[model samples]
Target: MVEITNMCRTTGCAIGDIKLYCAGFTSANLINPLIFRHLPTPNHDYCIVNNGNPLSAGAVLSFHYDNTFMYRDFSVSTVTCIS
Candidate 1:
């Protein structure tokens, strides 16, 4: 089991307009049906998920927005998983 908390900020656009991407893995094993919870942030209405479907290990997640000129930064505040 693993828990990850992602935090992000957007520039040149509203948070609601920003999109995020992600990838997950466990050592050499890929995590299918990658499960996670979205935490709330102040003034941010953005939510990130595994494409509304399960995520596989080593899978590349991508995000986009209407404005391609916007810049967004993402960070994993907390990551908890068995090694």
Candidate 2:
């Protein structure tokens, strides 16, 4: 699940050009494939990914966005492990 917040108070940004990528433990060293493309947004969108496989330990997930004009890129990562 991804929640994007537009910090721009006066102007809304476009998130439709973003890309999501994922790679499991076995492929950690290699670049992962594009899991999702062109996320839908309605200004401050909360997106849930349902098509990809469940994430396991040592899995890495990332997103890429193109910053053009007045847009800035933001990246965040969170990890949780259960024993």
How would you encode candidate 1's per-residue C-alpha lDDT over 35-73 as one tens digit per residue? 322324553433345424433333444433233233344
- Where model 1 places Cα greater than 4 Å from the true spot, the runs are 1-40, 51-54, 79-83
lDDT of 2 by residue, 1-83 (tens): 22434233332332222323222112213322444332345432222232233343333445443323322232322222222
Off by over 4 Å in 2: 1-34, 37-44, 50-52, 69-83
Q: Which candidate is the best by TM-score?
A: 1
Clashes of each: 1, 0
- List TM-scores for all candidates, in order: 0.32, 0.28
Q: Candidate 2 — what's its lDDT?
A: 0.32
What TM-score would you give candidate 2 relative to the actual structure? 0.28
lDDT at residue 29 of model 1 (Cα atoms): 34
